[model samples]
Each structure stands twice: as structure tokens, then as C-alpha cells.
Target chain A: MSTDLSRVADPGSIKLYTTEPDHHDPITLRSIGFWLYMMSDIMIFAGLFAAHGVYGDAYGTSKITAAQVIDPISALFPTLFLFSSVLFFGLAGVALKNNDRKEVLRWMTAAFVVGLVFVLQEIWEFVKLAQEGAVPQASAFLSDFWTIVWAHGLHVIVGLIWMAVVLIQVLRDGFTEAVVGRFLNLRIFWFFQAVVWVFVYTFVYLMGVS
Target chain B: MAHHQSSPIDHPEIQSASTLQYVSAFVLGLALMIVSCIITLGGGLSQSSTLTWIGILALIAVVGQLYLLFKLDLSKTMIWHTVSAVLTIPLVFISIVVTMWMFQYLEMRVMVGGS
Candidate 1:
């Protein structure tokens, strides 16, 4: 209880955390809420996947098969691009941890560019499929494919916008606590997209072709 | 800095990022994609077996990203994330398996052969 100052701080010190003096860790809810949203997002994808499972091969005497329409190899390039984005984003996450503002910005730019390419490639695929008379109305199989894949594409676009906003926040504000929370949730969102894409590649591309 | 106003980076849940692991995970995922393409296009395996191998490889890739990228171990920091992610697992299988069964049953009951 000495009032005298000491340069020597206690070793092995730890403190219980609270977000605000009177608010019980409202920050944790930012992440947890995003986590829950991701769960519900999973259910949305699950419904789409179920539709694919049900209608994918069940062309119901229609001449079109998923195999004839989908180019599995088209997905591979986008896979490489998007997964690389994830890697870059992971690097950005580390940079954010170190509070290296420049590194965070650099890696985030890389991630955003790569993600943009992936989205462009996806759009290209959609155009080609549409020109080939493979619109959603063509078959239940096509309907499910377009719905599920476009749903994912929309998420990626939203993620791209979120990332842009967060990137600006980081560039403008440095690693403030609020910025960190948004970035963390966006990391989860970005990562979950990659995860969902893996399944899409396997089930939609590889399985569709094989 | 005041004791209560500590850095968010100081939190126990925020593990130091490993560049090597993240790169390795990326490489592993890319390798799996190549292998899947080979399996499908190389004419090595029958279609059924190709699908099976691709499924296995995809699972490996998913688990790799979760472990390497997200650092989703059962560490104290990852408990909530781990639990929430785990909660989605059963739902995935249920959606897939039940959909397959129901569709197969529906096809059997209603439709033509091999369309």
C-alpha cells in the first residue's frame, strides 16, 4: 500500500477484462454476434446445398445435365484466386495484431484485388453459362446451381465492400478498438466464404463433372 | 497505458500469427485442388471414385483452413468459436444426407430411369 512510485512492475500480472466501465464487454458481443450470424449463414447455404442435392441430377427427363453445362475447370482458377485472398487476409490479421498499420493496409489491398478477380471470373462464368442457354429457368438443376452459387457470389461482393470500408477505416484511424472489432468480424466473414467455396468446388465442380 | 485501458492485442485469444503455417495451408489447399482436377480429368479413376477422393480432399482442405488460418484449436481463446463452429457440423450432415435420401426416394417414386 505504499504511495511511492516504482519503476518495477509486478511480474505475471493479469487483469479481468471489461469492455466499458459500466458495460460488460459489449465488444465480445460484436464477435459473438457475427459468429451467430455465420451459423445462420451456414443454414442458408445448407438450404441451397439441399436444393442442389435434390435437384442437381434430377433433370426430370430434361435434356440438360449438370455435367454437360458446368465447366469444372472454370472453378479452379477462382479457387486459387479466392484462397490466395484468404491467405493475404490472414497476413493482414497478423499485421493488425502487431498494429503494423502499413502492413495491414498492404495485405488488405492484396486481398481485395485477388477477391475482385475471383468475383470477375465468377461473373464471366455466369455470362458464359447464360449465353449457352443454361439460365436458371432451363432446369431445376440449373435453378439450384444458379441460386446457390449466386448467393455465394453475393456474399463475396458484400465481403469485398465490407473489406473496403474496413481498409479505409484502418488507413484513416489506425487500429482503434472499434476498427479492430469490425476487422475481426470481417475476417470471419471472409474466411467463411473460403470454407463455403471449398464445398462448392468439391460438390459443384468436381462432383458435377465426374 | 492504464491497466484497464490495455490493448486489444494483449488479449489471450489473439495468438501470434504464423506466416509459415498460413502459407503451408495455402499450398496444401492448392495441391488438393490440383489433385482433384487430376483425378477428375486424368481418366485415372472411375467417376464414383473420383467423387469420393474429391470429397475426402475437400474435407482436408476445409479442416486445414480452420486450423491454419483461423487457428481454431480448442485453446481457451477459441472456445466460443470452436463451439459455434461445431454447432454447424451436425446441421451440414443433416442437410446433405437427408436431402440425398429424400431426393433419391422421390426419384424412385416418380421419375423415369437414368435421365
Candidate 2:
């Protein structure tokens, strides 16, 4: 295998840089593979979303409905904060464009902090819901609601942990090819979270109330 | 991979990042969300109309965010990612829509009067 590391002319989507496709480029392979995983992950979410649609009004044996439990206007706060985190992550991508490690770290830290706020708010929302007897055990409607929303929250928490690890890696190791590749994949993950949230707030909270 | 040290900036994906795009997407998303909340909370519209508006706003938010933040454009660096992501849309629709349809039909046949 020729070790010529010249930039690939065709510019495969996630490739870092390589003229020849003879050997597996670690970053490129990892990113493309990770994205495929994300696609499958989204399909799982689709199933959950579909389940929610079917069980949406199944408030069996309970007097409460989704509107009684979820407040669409109040839900906007966490949504905005989550969107802010995405913007911060995108800014980190721009920082990466300039290869400015300090800027990247700063923006990533900002993203992490904002993301933390979002997760905390969501946890509080769930806490309040549980306190109001809106637990997943309450009804099929609440079950579906909690399941889908919790799934998204779990991903956010995982993303935050991943962000912390990436921040530490960037601080300790600087921007090595591996570190940058991991950051790239994390960016995609973070962006995907916001995309899913758009649907959650729209389909679950907004339309649920309506 | 270890022998060749390259700046991450040189990568086309990173190069595609635009501060302007991200900022605009954020602003657009925020504006749309506020409008949606207003429409939902104001109770000025019927339930169906409110649902329709929310769906429209959500679609706009999705498209804006996908294009700007995810950079799912037709550019050479993003074409593969874009194509793959787009391909999944139909599957999402089929899964969600088919399930809803099945349940709706079941309700009509099962219940004396449909919900």
C-alpha cells in the first residue's frame, strides 16, 4: 500500500485527507461507520415515535391527558437551550476550520455548559411530571410520552459525557487526527440530538397539547 | 495514519463550517419556536389549525437546521452524508404513518363510534 497521504481528489465526505483509498483511513472509516450507526439509531427513534402516535390518546383509566401534563409554552425553554448548544457546537466546527485549538475548546466548553442546562431542565420537567402522578406507569399515553422523551434525554446525557471526555482529550492530547475525528463524530451526534428534539417538541409537546 | 500529521482544518468537512450559517440557523429556529408556542398557547386557532402550523414550523426548523448545522448540502464533502440521511426520511415516514394508519383503522372497526 502506497503511504502517499496527499489529499484525495474526489473528497470522500468524511475523509480527513488521502489520495489513495488503498488502505482504510481511520478517521474517514470511523466517521462513515458512526454515521451509519446514527442512521440506525434514528430508525429506533422512529419506532418509538410511531409507538407514541398509536398510544397518544390511550389515557386508559386515567382522568389526565397529555395537555394536562405537558405545557408546550414552558417546554420552549429547554428547547431553546438545546438549540443554543447546537449552535455552540457548530461554532466549534468553525473553530476547527481555522485549526484554532483554543477556540475549539472554548466553544466546546460553551456547548457543554449549555447542554448541561438543557439536561437539568429536562430532568426537572420529568421530576415534576412524576410528582404530579404522571409517571410512565400512569397510562399508556404517559408511558409513550416518558419513553420517547426519556430516550432523547438519555442520549443528551451521554452526549454531555462524551463532550467532557473529548474536552479532556483535546486539552491533554491537543488536536491529533484521532481527537479531531472523535470530535467530528461528536458534532454529528450533537446535531442529530437537536434534530430529534425538533420533532419531540413539535409532535409530542405542541401537538399533544393541541 | 500516525506517520502523516495533518491539520484538521484542511479537512473538507471542517472547511464547510460557516459561522454565519450556524448563527442564522439558530436565530431562525428560535423565531420559529416562539411563533409556534404563541400559536399553540393563544388558543386563537382550532386544534387542527394549530397542529398544522406546528407541523409547518417544525418542518422549517428541520430543514434549516439540517442544511446549516449538519451541512447536509449537495457539496462534494457532504453529498454522501446528505444522500444517506435523505434516504432514511421515507423509512421514518412509513414507520410512523403506517402505524398511525393501522391504529386509526383498528379504532374505526373496533369502536362503535371512531375517536
Candidate 3:
């Protein structure tokens, strides 16, 4: 038998039909992928929370409780900065949708600034705490508190880098489909960080106050 | 090569639909952030029970933010994602509570016995 060269040579004639487009919806894929990454980040926080719970009362034969170490007044500014960062991310999302490249860059730049401010506030808080004899090794409460808060601060730093990357992409490509998809994904991730911060501020900061 | 007749990005309806989503996300995110700030600072220092209530309220705000900011919903395409998040969050909460409770119990026991 002659080799079936016709079918093999004319692959385009095979007529493979499907309702969906050949390319995956980049926005959807990016959204889902970023979500998965967020879940993984949540797991990291969960681990820290578990550690806090385990060592919550182990203040090394001392009476230093959670209430004594945390300063609610000092926490307020960083919380405001984090919330503002969320708003900036929202503006970036709006800019992405409007296909306004310049606005996207501006919003993301604002978000980065807000995030940096939050990080600075956190460092100041830590320094003040340390000055007040609340070092990480001073007591179990201090250790757990620093671990959880710093872990979150590290995440915000990573998010700022991610935003910077997206900003560069927008500057290079404008509002092209790839850039838009990436920006949306970054927005989702950044918003998730804000959500986690809400829990951190409420349970960790506010609860520690009383 | 011949040019394509139509592009999905050029579809006016699809363009408007995505724009609406973006707008909604912005409005909802801003509202939730303000609400959370008020709840945290406005709620004066109180007992554990009152603080717990505030925490619950903050959690609600976070859910709203996630829904509007990320457009995370339990649609068919996103069911698994929603389910995993819902389940995992509760697990994290329970783990924290139980661990803290255990530590508190042990501390109390040591105090009573040692005294």
C-alpha cells in the first residue's frame, strides 16, 4: 500500500473543529494563576498564625502578654498606607480596562509609593518596639508578632516588585492584550494582599490592643 | 497573506463588558477599604467578645473586597477556586484558635498546679 502521504502532508485539511478560540483567554488564565499563587501565600500566613497560637502564652517565665507588646496607635498609619495601596491598585485596574496606558503607569507608581510607605511605617514600628524592650528574642509574644508582621511586609515588597514589572510592560507595550492580561493578574494578586492585611490588622493588631 | 475579517478586541460589546467589570471593582474596593478602617479604629477598645465581633465584621468586609476587587465568584468556571479558598480560610482560623486555646489551657494548668 502506498504510504498515506495525503493526510499526513495536508494537516490543515483535517478540519479539527471546536467552539473555543485557538488561543486561551489570557486574562482568565492570568487571573486563575495569580489566585493560585495567592492561595500559596495564604498558606504561608497560616503557618505563621499557627506558630503564634502555639507560642502565644510562652513569654519565657514572664508576664508580657500580647496586649502589652502591640501598640494600636502606631499601627494605624501603616494600616492606612496599606489601604491606600489597595485603592491605587483599583485605579490601575480601571486604567487597564480603559486601555489608558499612561494612567496605568501612574496608578501603579502611586501604588508602589504607598506600599513603600507602609513598609517604612512597619520598620519604624519594629524599631520602636525594640527600643521599648520588645525585641524578637525578648519574649515569645514578640517573636510570634514580629514573624507574622514581617512575613506580611515581605509579601508587600514582592508585590511592589511585581507591580514595577507590570509598569515596565505597560510602558513598553501600551495596552496590548498581553500587557492588559498581566496587569489584571497583578491587580488581583495585589488586592488579595490587601484582603490578608485586613485580617492581620483586625486579628493581630486590634485584638492585641485589648 | 490575507488579513483577518474581525478581531475580538474590536468588538464594542465585549469592550464595554470588561470596562464595566473594572469600574465595579474600583468602586467596591474603595468602599470596602473605608469600611474596614472605620471598623478597626472606630470600634473602641473592648473585651475579647467585642473584639471578636469586630474581627467577624472585618472578615465580612474582606470577603466583599475579594468579590468585587478580584471578581472571585462561585460560577461554574470558578467553583473549585472559590471552594478551596472558603475551605482553607476556615481551616486557618480553626488552627489558630485551637492552638491558642491549647496554649492557654496549658498555661492555666501550670499556674494552678505550680501555685
In model 2, the runs with Cα more than 4 Å from the true position are A1-24, B1-5, B112-115
Report the TM-score of the second chain of model 2 against its true counterpart: 0.88
> How many residue pairs clash per model?
0, 0, 0
Candidate 1 chain A, which ten residues in sequence have the lowest lDDT sum? A3-12
Candidates 1 and 3 compared: the better one by lDDT is 1
Ranking by DockQ: 2, 1, 3
In angstroms, give how far residue A163 of model 3 lies from its true place.
Answer: 1.3
Rank by lDDT (best first): 2, 1, 3
Off by over 4 Å in 3: A1-23, A61-65, B1-46, B76-80, B101-115
Pitting candidate 2 against candidate 3, the one with the higher TM-score is 2
Candidate 3 chain A lowest-lDDT run of ten: A22-31
Question: What DockQ does every candidate get?
Answer: 0.52, 0.61, 0.26
**lDDT per residue, candidate 1, B11-95, as tens digits?**
4433447778779888988889888888888878887888888889999999998888777777655678889889889998899
Q: What is the lDDT of residue B2 in candidate 3?
A: 12
**The best candidate in terms of DockQ:** 2
Task: Mark the 10 consecutive residues where model 1 chain B has the least summed lDDT.
Answer: B1-10
Error of 2 at B16 (Å): 1.4
The share of true interface contacts that also appear in candidate 3 amounts to 0.28
What does the lDDT come to for candidate 3? 0.68
The collision pairs in model 1 are none
